[model samples]
Target: MHIEKNTFSLIEIPKIIDEKGRGNLSVIEKDGVPFDIKRVYYLYDVPSDAYRGGHAHKEQLELLIALSGSFEVVLDNGFEKKKVMLNKPNIGLLIPTGVWRELENFSSGSVCLVLASDVFNENDYIRNYSDFKLFVGA
Candidate 1:
């Protein structure tokens, strides 16, 4: 596999809500065609000083959004690294394949919502650090 470093992508999602609304709705449409949502998951009540997401996927694409409070996502793309702070529900970060990530620094009442392109598969995860390095051709 050919893995490139520093491959994280930040995307702005188009909103469907208007100015008169007090509440919001989640809608995804491309070229006037709406895409069906497959899976929806959220993470809340995360303990302080606790870390999550220390792995990379072989073929999974994920979109991470902070629904409340704030948090930092540390991304490692083999040869480079970056930290992204997520504190708004309207903004989302698109995490691509072959990039290792660690979610940390959760503020009080922080909630993280994740949308994945594929279903869960344990075999697709590279959990070990040395193994992940080797897998990325490090």
Candidate 2:
């Protein structure tokens, strides 16, 4: 999965609003998501100044959505960096392989939902910043 620096993007999912409330759903079909879903996880009860995810994947794709509250995701592709805010339940940020990401500035009661393309594998992770930079040829 040779991803370029511009591979990451934000996708807006459809939200159904009605008289009672609002609802949204996400699918991992071929046309819906870039890859098939293999894992799902969520993060909640994070302190206001807490942070998470400071690594890059060797071959995995992820979609991050803020189910409630808000948070910020900082992405680095060795050559360039980008920061994105996740505050909408119906929107998600697509992070491809080879990009280092860090979740920070989480608002209280924030719930972050993550859809992954692969199952858990410790060997697939590049946790060190220097190593990640070398892997991405920075």
Which one is best on lDDT?
2
Question: Which parts of model 1 have CA positions greater than 4 angstroms off?
Answer: 1-6, 16-26, 30-37
- The C-alpha TM-scores of every prediction are 0.83, 0.89
Which of the numbered candidates is closest to the native, going by highest TM-score? 2
Q: Would you give me the overall lDDT of model 1? A: 0.78
Candidate 1 per-residue C-alpha lDDT over 1-138 given as tens digits, one digit per residue, 9 for 90 to 100: 122333766656556576787776655444212123356798899986988899998877677888899999999878888999998777778777788999999998999988876778898888997888888887
User: Where is model 2 poorest over a 10-residue stretch in terms of lDDT?
Assistant: 21-30
Give the TM-score comparing model 1 with the true structure, all chains together: 0.83
Q: Candidate 2 regions off by >4 Å? A: 1-6, 19-30
Residue 16 lDDT, candidate 2, scale 0-100: 60
lDDT of 2 at 14: 68
Residue pair clashes in candidate 1: none
- Per-candidate clashes come to 0, 0
Give the clashing residue pairs of candidate 2, or none. none
